[model samples]
Target: MSRAAGRLKVGIRVPPCDRADRIVRTVRRAEELGFDSAWFPDSQLLWRDVFTTLTAAALGTEQIDLGTAVTNLATRHPAVIASAARSVAELAPGRFTLGLGVGDSSVAPVGLRRSTTAEMREGLTVLRTLLNGDEWEFTGPGGTVRSRLRDPHPAIPLHLAASGPRNLRLAGEVADGVILLSGVSPRTLAGAMDRVREGARAAGRVAEAVPLTVSAYCEVTDDIEAAARRIKPICATIARNGGAPFLALAGIEVDVPDVVDGVYPDLVHAEDWDTAVRVASAWVDDAAALRFAEEFCLFGTADEIARRLRALHADGVRGVFLQHVGSYDPPLDLIEAVGASVLPAL
Candidate 1:
């Protein structure tokens, strides 16, 4: 069952690694540039608090939607998440979305376990109940306690960021929306959506009614082959972590170490991206990187990107939040370039 195509909402991922005011300015700039939404990433050690950034963005901008590209449940308890989501919803009213994901950067650094699917289901149930101004029961060593969030905003949407089969199905079954981590590849996206639709059908929900949002790495460049070399780390990281089949769809093969040492945080969010690319090149060559870029990423000129985005919209992608290559830096250039050139063209 294919979803009927609709207007494609374009959003940008702004890492909240700077001061709250600076982050707000970036979001304001995005709004001025005609971008539909500005998404922020949450990593305690890597960036400033996501809620703090969202709070400032809420007050600074009047129109553009605001959301976490995602925050994780493992690092925060469900009750705390309820309170935070409620607080942000109050600030932005109909514009706030709370996106949750299995802890990656947030938990690995602290030696904490990521949320399991069962845990995610339980957490979503608790969050939904509390955010709707109802009580949720928590069973502990002492006894079962019931608590409800104050100043609840039932309008706040809960989006799940998922890439795996199980989590993707869970998002389809329970979430208000889905943040798809499978880039913009038609083949992989089709497979991921199949899993999602199966789950929604199992839950007796109309699969096409659920909102789909894609997260992809994007750049506005004429020299795509040269630019593709920078994303070698990303290509290798995805293949290393059980996404080789997705790459196989684009006819690219890579073999990376299960554990790649020397990168500070991880291969995807490595501090020295150049060194990371060099290391990953042992497995993923320039030709492979170019194929990944052409098939998976949005790396091309303005016209090229706009055309690709149109294709994605035709394929049932409701929204796409573009990410620049690096994790720490703000996508100011991307926002300006795509906002001026690509958005107007679209």
Candidate 2:
């Protein structure tokens, strides 16, 4: 299952919902649909248990890789995540990647905050050590203690999700792969990749040693204008979080409306997606939404999206995580669309 050095890979993100069976079906379908990986998001109170759903996916399917697009250290202990990751790795063998990140939706509603960059480094160190079956010092509440996994899974690929310069650098220096959150604009991707190279140089390694991926909302439709509008809320969500810097770098300006400020648990977590999309459309508008699609997202017809993806691969992106527009469940139709139209061209 060795990855061809410069080949592009596609993965799908599925939210585990109240119906565990549906999540399993979605993951299996993603596999059958020719995706390279199945990524699950961990937002416990908002969705089904990540590990539980992933376990089900692992048992029901073979061949497709699987992992968290991200889980966080604030909500789950590094040792625990490391152990849980090992269990999934055992199920899929070389197909699991442990993608870690600063807390987002998974923590915010519970009033937990993301870890500082220094804390993230410490967390990764702890997880990597424990997964190698070595004892590591754990510190928190009372005092520091040593812990280790009895039977470790040492070779699981560890990917880090990052957006800011410093975090991107950290990912380059330490991560086996980086899930770039800067979106897919050529300028933004170029800037983020520079940071990655900087970190790799600092760590005394080649920049190409680390793989890179970016997530994009995917839809295959004849109506370009409508699809552009549908991606507005997602574009707005990206704009509010560390996106302003990259937007400025790319000469793109998106107005973040006051209404967006009042949304709870983040815009992407809204259960009533129709309302969320409607509210987002006010600020995102037609011009800005279409512009966001041009610069950030991978939304369009199969041929158009595939051409853009090929450009990404040429520029060093090894993977793309295609996201569905809804909140509670996997968008099965979008999965089918990507499989039929985009996968072949890629």
Candidate 3:
């Protein structure tokens, strides 16, 4: 698709908490609703196996594209990731995209950490080489796995889940697409696009040639305030440290306490609702949270959302991936509303 066409690709970030039946139903519903893509996250021991979930999602849907929003290179070698991506592409043909990231916050639970940006860049280089049906030789901790595509090459797009400046730049320089984390404000989005453009130019690629997909946390409801309150916890945590570069662009500051070194994991593993709210509130205030919710999320009336989304398109965003927070039913409501009411206007 032409960049000017500005596709409105809406899909949910499959939470690790969901059940198998629920996931299938969600994927099927997304496809029926005309959503462009559906992405499942990779968290291994923290959650279900990402490739397995993606296979199920792909098998459940007919038209919607399936992807990893992202699978980290820290856990699996690039060749292994390439093999998995190739397998999934075989299952869905042109409907699979491989979204890679450094790793998720859950890595800490298993006494692990994300790979550095340089490591991620090298990993992507390896992944791209393998995906393009080229043979690669590498020596890593796992001895050696020299390989090449023996089967028919699938048209699987490689997307990077980028939050920091280095990763975002690398994504623009190399990746087919970039997946911005949820809770990004318009200012942040614009700044990210600028960075992507800079990297693309440096790499001798047209700015618009590379697809930019912004993922946001959205909950559609008449009571916008209530929805904002519900979304605050998740957004705050993401804002604090997980996606700090983007949130910093939005002018939201995160005052993290020395006691709680990692804000995101602290919020995610918070024992109760009160603790969760406390943890999230520390990073994001009501005004900032509301602004982020309004600017990033597709909330309020369908007409209002459509109008805002059109404005976003005008601003240069190619597509969106809406992450539904809270209950599954609300996401279904938002998806149906967007497809039936908002997308028609677009």
Candidate 4:
């Protein structure tokens, strides 16, 4: 047997918006930069088709892993999602992971809703079964039907993006890995881990065996406050969805943002830059925003961010994925900075 070499792992998430040229360039760049994976978001109306983008990346790049940073089970059928995931796996071989989540941005635009925990369980079961080429019989419109994947891919992993206690626990029970959305704050991340651990224990599984990927919008900027301001909408989103853990870091509850009441999914992408920051101020004022920057985002100097990242790895974080602020544009600046300073530090 031949021994394989080792490499450092770094994942960058990109949304395939209107620019096909930009997406391809970014993924190719990531591969050149020695990144471990290139993940894409899925929202048919908000961005480009996730599978189409992944397939393109698979054919375009030779080594970098390709995946959905996440796709929603609420919007797509499990059978269909499994088939799409299997097809991508066929292209990339062992480098594809299917990251599933309850619907959010994708469902909101169409006046649909996210799937509940129970729904998620059933959906994952069906998706995994069929992806393994095992006939899975489930009740359809009128009765049950058995089906299997035409091209099975049992190696493809299912990573769940989860935060709420119950849902976090569910990830521990079933997911191959978990995409931690509870923020980078140690307090909240620790709390979220507790929920996941509880779930894993209840399921008779070892929590430590499951890998965890923590994500944040990262940038190296001298003016951290300004960078933080750009992230207000995301802060407000955490508040609106379930801010208890995040709020604990800020020493407050979800009291600041009535401004985000009517916005769908999040105010970050729904409004313009100026309007989004302005509305985010209703909750994330100067002190709060700065605190948010320090505690949650990767928006500090390279030295500072690198130190914290090492601390996160010490805290059991397996890998980190950095998201660019805007969905449509690539974060060349952050990527360059992280590659220069952050990746080496880790």
Query: Which structure among the candidates has the greatest lDDT?
Result: 1
lDDT of 1 by residue, 238-342 (tens): 999889988998899887879898888988888899889888898999999999999999999999999999998887788999999898878899999999899
**Candidate 4, 55-138: lDDT as tens digits:** 888888888888898898878889889889988888887788899989888888898999899998888888888988899987
What TM-score does structure 2 among the candidates reach? 0.94
Q: On residues 61-105, what C-alpha lDDT tens digit does candidate 3 reach at each position?
A: 778878888788777878788888888888787788888887755
Give the Å error, residue 31, model 1.
0.4
Q: What lDDT score belongs to each candidate, Candidate 1 first?
A: 0.89, 0.82, 0.71, 0.79
Order the candidate numbers by TM-score, best to worst: 1, 2, 4, 3
Off by over 4 Å in 1: 1-6
Q: In model 1, what is the error at residue 198, expressed in angstroms?
A: 0.9
Among all windows of ten consecutive residues in candidate 4, which has the lowest summed lDDT?
1-10
Clashing pairs in 3: none
Q: Who wins the TM-score comparison? A: 1
Question: Residue 28 of model 4: what lDDT?
Answer: 88
- Residue 74 CA displacement from its true place in model 1, Å: 0.5
Models 1 onward score TM values of 0.97, 0.94, 0.87, 0.93
Record all residue pairs in model 4 with backbone atoms less than 3 Å apart, i.e. clashing: none
